[model samples]
Structures are given as C-alpha cells and as structure tokens.
Target: MTVQLRHLFALATCALLLGGCASNPPATARYDFGPLPAPSTSSQIGTLIVADITGPTALDTEHMQYRLLYADARQARPYAYNQWAATPFQLLGQRLRANFAQAGVKVLSTTDAITSPTVLRMEVNEFTQSFDTAKSSQGILNVRASLFRNHRLLDQRTFQRSVAAPTPDAAGGAQALAEASDALAADLLAWLASVPQP
Candidate 1:
C-alpha cells in the first residue's frame, strides 16, 4: 500500500476509536445525600441506636431504580448510567442518624456498648421514582419504622412520602428523594417523641 493510503487508514482507525469512546462514556455519575445538619446541644433526649436498614433484593444494591407507570406500572427499571454513591438502605441509616443527632437526640450505633438503649429499626419497603408520563415523575419513599426500648418493641409505624420531581430524569428523582428523606426524618422524630419511653 502507498504511504498516503497507510496514513489514511491509521486516521480512520483513530477516528473510530475516538467515536466509540464518545458513545460509551464512563458511567461515573455518582449521587449522594448532601451534608447533614449539625448535632444539637440543647435539651437532649436519650440515646437511640440505628440498626442496619433491611430491604428487598432489588434495593440491596447501589443501583438507582425507577418504575415505569406509563408502560408497565408493575415493572421497575434501573438507570444504565446512573447510580447512588451508596445503597438507599445504607444512606437511610446515615441520614437518620444525622437527623436524630441534629434534633438533640443522642444517636448511637450498633457498635455501641449500650445494650438496652432505644433502637430504631427500619425496613425499607419501597424506594423508587415512578414515572406516570414521559415528562413527569415522583420519588416514592416507604419504610416501616419500629422503635425498641429495654429490649421490647415500643412503637411501630409505616411512613410513606412522595415528592414531585421537577423533571422526569434521574437527577430530578434524586432531588425529590432527598426532600422526601428530610420529610421522613422529621416525621420519625415526631412519632418517636409521642411514643412512651422505656
């Protein structure tokens, strides 16, 4: 082959490689709940330990999920190129601890030496964005919250919060989920206050 023809072939190959890289950009977009409120120091409540949140197999991973209400209301989908920095279950525990601490409620972990302190156990039943239309979606957060004191169950409640997405994309769902999380934290604190302490 001629030198000019060989150079042309090399350029073509390079162009194809570059185009492939462009089309298949790395799936590196990572989202997480932002900074939490500072711990409060005034009128303190007794310590509460947060247990690891449990959930179904689908939600056990870091994949960000959504339901397609427009196509199939029962089907859930994970974004191909988007993901949470951590699983929802794990994030929930972290956020709850932060929220409780900020409300002047001493937050403890399972690793603490205390044996009978109040415990907050949560089962995440549903956590996903559901798209009703191509242009709109809502973040749905559902959890069964149970409080234990002195090794006895004190109170249990199911909390559900849905927040409208500003857009129909994963970013919108993430923002909505964050808002719903804040709402859930507030609701849980109120419920805990009303429950009889051990």
Candidate 2:
C-alpha cells in the first residue's frame, strides 16, 4: 500500500477505536448512606423545623469528591467511575430527618406550613475524602450549624469529623464519608438537645 494510504488507514482505525471506547464507558458506581442504625428511644425534643441545607455550589451535585493532601490539598477531584446517588446535601438531609424522627423529635419540614419557634440550618463548609498518603486516607466533613427561633439566631456552632477509610480506593472513601456524615448528625442532635429552645 502507498505511504499516504497506509497513514490514512491507521488514522481511521484509531478514530474507530476511540469512538468505541467513548460509546461504551465503564459502569459507574453510585453510593449513599446504606441504612439507619437502631432508632433512638428518646422522647421528642418538641416541634422543630429543618431547613434545607445550604453550601457552596460545588456541593450541590452528585459528584463524589476526594483530595490528595499529600499532593495538593487545595484541589478536589471527582471519581471517574464512582458517584453519589444524589447530592451530598440531599443524602445528609434524609439521614438527619430520619435520625430526628427516630429520636422521637417532632421533626418538621421547612414546607410543613406549621409554626415552630425552633429551626435548624446547616452550611456545609467542606466535604471530601482526603488522602494523606498513597495508602492513607480519611473522609472529612465540616459544617456550620445554626439554631434559630422566630427567624433569629438562637445558637450556632461548627462541627467537623474525619473517619479513616477502610481502604484506599473510591469504595473505601465512600464508606468513610458515610461514617463521617453519621458522626456529624450525632453531634448535631446532641447540640440541639443542649440549646435553650423557645
């Protein structure tokens, strides 16, 4: 075959291979908090509404993020073949609602159309799986919480948790993140109990 014809053939073959690969991407894995633990038998803390969680625009999506602290702690990267079943906030909210209800707290939604003197709000500051070394990683979650009465601030605090990953891959990161999120919820619940409700 002529040199030019051979080159053209090679380019066509390369394009076909690339197109096939693009069309058949690897299966993506989705993660979420698996299940609720044993319910709390405590009585209701009284009527309280949980406002929708707010955070930086980055946390508004279904991306499962991680950071390499040993490399560039400032940069967060997404898993190519792993993701959350929903936005991080959505999942966290579900867990919080369930936990509060299980604890016998008369949990109310922001849209419940009911009057309540107490409301809980959260602003997620950071949520990512951070790797300190090639084989060492932890899921870090940081959030600022505010308790309000009559739309005025009643109390506020920042909560943070870091759970070690069982392994070094995305699966491990996901598990660690789930644990960290649960820890945050526990902390928030305890704090609520301490606040002077109106």
Candidate 3:
C-alpha cells in the first residue's frame, strides 16, 4: 500500500479508539428496600406520648462526591450528589409513631392531648456520616438515642448503620441513605416494644 494510504488508515484507527472511550458511560446502580415486617403481637397497649424531639440534630445534607479506590488498585473516581427528606430527629419521631401505631397503641400530641397517661421523650446523642472507598461508595450513618418518660429516663440506646451506593451515582447514594434510615427505624421500633409499660 502507498505511504499516504497507510497514514490515513492509522489516523482513522486512532479516531475510532478515542471515540469508543469517550462514548462509554458509567454503570448505573439502583436499590429497592424490601417490605418491612409488622410488629409482634406481644407489644403492650398504652398511650404513646411523643414530646418534642430535642437536639443537637443531624440532617441529610445535599449529596456530595468523594473518592473511591477499587480492590484492583484502580481508582474509580467520583461523581454525582444526593440528599435526604428529614433530619435525624424527625426520622426518629416518625418511626416511633408508626411503630407504636402498628402495635395498637394510641398516640398523644403534647399540644392537643394533655391528658395522656404516659409521656415519651427522646434525646439525640450522635448522628454523623463516614465514607467507604473500597466499595466505590461514599457514606455511612451513625446515631445514638435516649428515651424518657414523664421527665425521667427510661432507656438509652445507640444505633449504627452503613449506607452506600450500589453504583457511584447521586441517586444511588440517596437510595442507600434512605434504606439505612428505614433500617434504623425498624431497630428503634423493636427497642421501643421491649420497653416496660407504666
């Protein structure tokens, strides 16, 4: 073949290779939380009084990016951002209410219902996020909770759960966080059920 034709062929091959690399898209990750189990029949029937959740509170901030190192010594890089619906205090309150309701307990608001037989209050101790790099992901949530009754301490507990994206994307990270929150809710409910009734 002529040198001119050979040169043209080489340039075409290089362009094709570069084009393929540029068109490649990152993998997408998704998460689906299975349905939660119902409360056990052994839970007690009582008036559930939920007081205002006092904080030092923690909230799901807008999603951000972080670096990840794969197991193969390859750098996966970072991309995308995410966020959550409620703060830690808000999440705890909602979960407590839902779980108690499922147990057939009546809920009493402090403003409208003052005649409740018992009052439940909670204090948040810790809520923070940490990152994981080996899994090509960004964060984990840790929390500590305390329970009270009529201004007296009833029980205090700590909870920790890992939240990570299935893929390095904002939506996936958000989904992981939400799933972690739901798991926290379930754990809190189980603890509440075990509390002695007044």
Best by TM-score: 1
* lDDT digits (tens) for residues 41-79 of candidate 3: 435546767776665412333223243333332332233
**Superior by TM-score: candidate 1 or candidate 2:** 1
Better of 1 and 3 by lDDT: 1
What would the per-residue lDDT of candidate 1 be over residues 74-147, giving only the tens digit for each residue? 88899988899999998888887788777887787888887547888999999999998988899999999988
How much lDDT does each candidate structure score?
0.85, 0.87, 0.57
- Clash-forming residue pairs, model 2: none
Root-mean-square deviation (CA) per prediction: 2.8, 3.5, 7.7
C-alpha displacement of 119 in model 3, angstroms?
Answer: 4.0
Best by lDDT: 2
TM-score of 1: 0.87
lDDT of 2 by residue, 81-172 (tens): 89999998888888888878888788899899877878999999988899999999999989999998888998899999999999998899
Error of 2 at 18 (Å): 10
- The TM-score values for the models, in the order shown, are 0.87, 0.86, 0.55
Model 3 bad stretches (over 4 Å):
1-42, 52-82, 85-88, 123-129
Clashing pairs in 3: 63-82
How many residue pairs clash in each candidate at the backbone level?
A: 0, 0, 1
